[model samples]
Target chain A: MAKKFLQRLGLKDKLLAIIVPLLVLAAWQGAVSQKLCSELILTPPLTLLNTLLELAQSGDLTLNILASLKRVMIGFLLGGTSGFVIGILMALSPFLNRIFGPLIKALQQVPEFAWMPLIIMFLGIDEFAKYFFVAIGAFYPMVLNTYQGVSGVPEKYHELARVFDYKSFRYLFKVIIPSALPSIITGIRLSLGLSWMFVVGAELFGSDSGVGYLMTWGRAVFQIDLVMAGLILVGVIGFAMNFLLERAEKQFLLWREPVDGRPA
Target chain B: MSNNKGTLEIRNLSKSFIVDNSPLQILNNINLTVTSGSFVSIVGSSGCGKTTLLRIILGLENHYDGEALMDGKQIVGPGTNRGIVFQDHRLLPWLTVGENVAFGLDKLNRKEKKLLVDEHLQLVGLIGFESVYPSQLSGGMAQRVAIARALANKPEMLLLDEPLGALDALTRMYMQKELERLWQLEKITMIMVTHDIEEAIYLSDKVVIMSSRPGIIKQIIDVSSSRPRDRASSEFMQIKAEILEEFHLGTEYTFAYAI
Candidate 1:
């Protein structure tokens, strides 16, 4: 009975999600204006907004965002495509799987951050080093998801491939790839998210440009409002990317029937 | 539309598997021949290895002991000469009906592929459903798409592994008529694996009934009844009775063979 009541009491309108955040913001602003919290620790809401607009007006925000986006996009593209292909190969070939599967798995167990010192030592604190690090971040999830998708394809489709006498290339490209697309899409989404985090981390650690660098500079100067603005932009952009990918999935996967009016 | 091809002969075709480190025989000493442009149904109770037999004929199960020959050639692996409609239809969910039909025709030009797809869809009576997805279709409709996909390849032999088994009774009866019509119109050999005896009687030139526990043909009964067969006729009932007796389930007697 309590569970039923909770179910019914759940957000009746999705717009209701904005309420608590708005309330918290209003309280935060009220406290900050009255000096109940120090400006050094928590920048006032109005000051934060001013800093955001000023950054936009001066085009610094745009430059920083573009720099960050370039790194993320390149890293994601390089990592995602290779991950997809290599994952499929791993699933298809027993010899390749035996050779590299366990080695990769063992490497993944070592913290990714652990690779940073070795990478910086060899490549130096340059753009290539950052790109390489971010690419590594994008690689793991994409490979895992693509491997699962290809390996776990229903046996019936394999039978169909046999009946058609599809050559290996045709079998992989036409049947295996398409059948595993939904899973690959999942990998791409996850890998994109990882790439975003990785680019930000790379910039924070070394780069003299990008949103992460801007936040680092703001901290060096004690400009808390600029740091807050950068955080807001990151959250909003990440949300937008996720939303667009979801919409694309719905469009391409229209053949799948939904359950309870939600896309399956 | 008759041609001098799609003749299949199974000679001493026996199969076994290493189940739990023991050689568990699945099929034993099976022998059958299906002529070109004929409709044959293999009927038996569950565990009869009828599906395995079809897979062997389809050249998917290649570890069998003896030869499964088609048109005087040894059936080795799956070829474009044979197309199969699996029990669940098995249409690729991401593909539309038209794309699914066009899937196997890699050698053809785009225009030829489109024409063949349209023609096969028409033959299966699903011509306007080209843009539709399998999930948007009914079970019977999906099975029709499967048939259309198989026919699109223009194979000499079409294998159906209980293609209509998932449909409701009314739809099954309707599809029985549809299958008969399709077989007659296409003039190709069709080998269907079914457990439905009356379905076997209604559509097949020959009904090969097998016994379980080492699936072997118990009888190959010929039905020479004319086209558009009557299910309610005494002849149909008698054939149903004969099949039920072979399975030792003869008492029930009620069948539109849609059961």
Candidate 2:
């Protein structure tokens, strides 16, 4: 009965989802008022909100966000496209899979940050280094997921394709790709999250204007409120990106009926 | 509708598979001839290799010895000349009913493909369900779509591997009538593999029975009764009894029917 009620939630019940967070915030504010910790160490939510507003007024927040967004887009496109292509190639050809499969697995094992020092030395502390780092982060998940998606297509579908005597390109696009789309979309979603995470890591070392840089600057100047504001902004932007991608996924996968027999 | 277009001749057909190391024979010394536009049903219990025989004729399995000839040519592999519907509807989940039918008409231009898809959809009496995806369809409806898909290619022979097996009893009976209508209208040769004895008797021009343990054809009974055969008719019961007797299931089946 509780599950049924939850499933049939109205607007009033939907609003209840926010109650826990609001209560947590109230407790946090109360603790700050009672001087539970030093002000510099723990900034209240109100002070962080004020800092956010001030940054917004100064236009530095928008500039930094745009700079970070630009880097993310460039890196995601470069990494996603190449990963998608290579993944498909690997899935289609046993020879290519054998040649590069081990190498990809090895690269996946090494931490993304471990390559940072060498990448900085090779490409210097410029946009290229940051972009390269983010690309590497995004690339691995995309490759792994796409490879799995393509390689694991049901043999029945392949038999259907054979029955139709579908041409190679037609089979790949119409049968293979559409069939593997759910997995590929999952990979893309993971890649996007990884890209966002790598942006902070990429900006942490030798970066002047990004959300990560903003946080670093706040830390350097002992401004806890500014750091909290930066953290909030990153969280909000990541949530927004994820929300948009989820909407896209829903649109693309409209034909897929839910396994539990819920409405598509 | 030219009835002379789809003649099938199978001669000295045999198939076996290597299970572990020893060759376990699945089909043995099978021979059958199906005239153009005839409805032939191969009925046997499970493990009788009826489906395997259908697959061999459909050119899905090639390791078998002997000949499967469509018209005058030897069957090589799955081609447009022969269309098939499996026990499962097997419609791609991503495709709508219309799109699934159109999947067979890959060679046609878009306009022609649309026309053919519509025609076949209407042929299967699914005119308004063009946009509905496969997942939303009931078992009987999905099988109808499968039939539409098979007919979209305008193959000389339509192969059915228990196409209506998944449907409920009521739907199965309804679909059997629909299958009869389709056969009459299309005038294409149909080779169906089924285990249901009554189903074999109801629609088939000829019913071929096979025995298991190195599956081999035991007998082929001719159903020369008129169209719209009555299930309770003596003629139908006689043929059903004969087929059951071959499987040593005659007394038991009759007792079950009496109950």
Candidate 3:
């Protein structure tokens, strides 16, 4: 009965999700009006909104966003493609799996930021260093997810391929890859989030141009409003990217039945 | 060597499995012959090696010591000439009914593939469900699509491993009639492994009864009844009684321990 009631109140549930955020914003405004927190530390929501508008009007916001987006695209393409290839190869061959499996596991244990200092020293704090960091962040999850996806394909599908006498290429593309696609898409989504997080870490140390750099610049100048605005923009963009990818996943996996047996 | 195009001859077939460091035999000295354009059923209780025998004939298991020959050629491994439908309708979940049927016809041109798939879908009475996915179909419909997929290859011999075993009794009965109709229409050699004695008698030209514990053929009873034979007929009852007697399930047991 409760499930049916909840299902009927779908729109209300969506509205309810925003209630906590609204209450927090109201409390923040109250604190700022009463001067409970200094502007240098907190930078109340209205002041941050004004700073965001000013930055947008001056074109600084668009420039930083474009720069960061460019870095993410290049790093994502290089990391995602290589990881996909390597993952498939490892799953296909036992020799490669045995050789690289332990090495990858060890690398994954090290945080993406841990390599920042050494990478900057090698590449000299240029665009290449940032790209490398983001790529590294994206690569590990992609590889692990792809390997799991490919290896987890049902043995029965392989038997069907054999019975049909399918060619190797056809079998791989039609059976193995499609069967593993849901897991692969999930990995790609995770890598996308990692790339965003790594971009911030990459820019926090030594960069002049990207959204991450803008936040650091605001911190150095003691412009707390600008910093808060930058953080909000980053969060909004990440949320938007995730939403878009979820839609794409739905489009690609139309054949999957909904777990709750709901109509499409 | 059998002169008929679809004749399958199995000779001195035996299979064993390594269980806990000891060799356990599964099928022992099994031999059977299925002629062209005939339906043969292997009926036995679970663990009677009926499925193992089908797997051997399909050439999925090469470890068995025997010769399974089709049209005078020794079977080696899975080939397109032999199509199979497993007990669980192993259709690819990502594909629609039409695509699943066309899966085995990869060598055919696109137009030819479509035509064959459509024809077989119609043959299995699933003509309007071409675009539907397997998950959306009922158990019986899914099994029919599996049948269509198997027949799409136009194989010389079709192997079914209890194809309707997962369906309800009503659906099973309907599918049994459908199987008979399909056999009459297609005229291909078919070998089905089933647990239902009545089902075996209803659809098959010959019922091969097997015994458990290193499974071997106990008897092969030929059904000389004509097509559309009545299930309640005296002849049908006689054949059913004979098969039940082999399994020690005959009517004689009812009065054996009378109070």
Which model scores highest in lDDT? 2
Assess every candidate by TM-score.
0.94, 0.94, 0.94
Q: Residue-wise lDDT of candidate 3 within A91-122, one digit each (tens)? A: 98899999998899998898777897799789
TM-scores of chain B alone in all candidate structures, in the order given: 0.95, 0.97, 0.95
Native-contact recovery for every candidate?
A: 0.76, 0.54, 0.61
C-alpha RMSD over true interface residues, model 1: 3.6
Q: Write the per-residue lDDT of candidate 2 for residues B145-175, one digit (tens) a residue.
A: 9999999999999999998898899999999
Return the top candidate by TM-score.
1
lDDT of 3: 0.88
Question: What residue runs in model 3 are displaced by over 4 Å at the alpha carbon?
Answer: A1-11, A260-264, B1-3, B253-259
lDDT of each residue in B82-107, candidate 3, tens digit only: 88999989989889999999999888
Candidate 1's C-alpha runs over 4 A off are A1-12, A260-264, B251-259
Docking class of 2: acceptable
DockQ of each: 0.59, 0.47, 0.47
Q: What share of the true interface contacts does candidate 3 keep?
A: 0.61
- In CAPRI terms, model 3 is classed as acceptable
Predictions ranked by lDDT, top down? Answer: 2, 3, 1
Best prediction by DockQ: 1
In candidate 3 chain A, where is summed lDDT lowest over 10 consecutive residues? A255-264
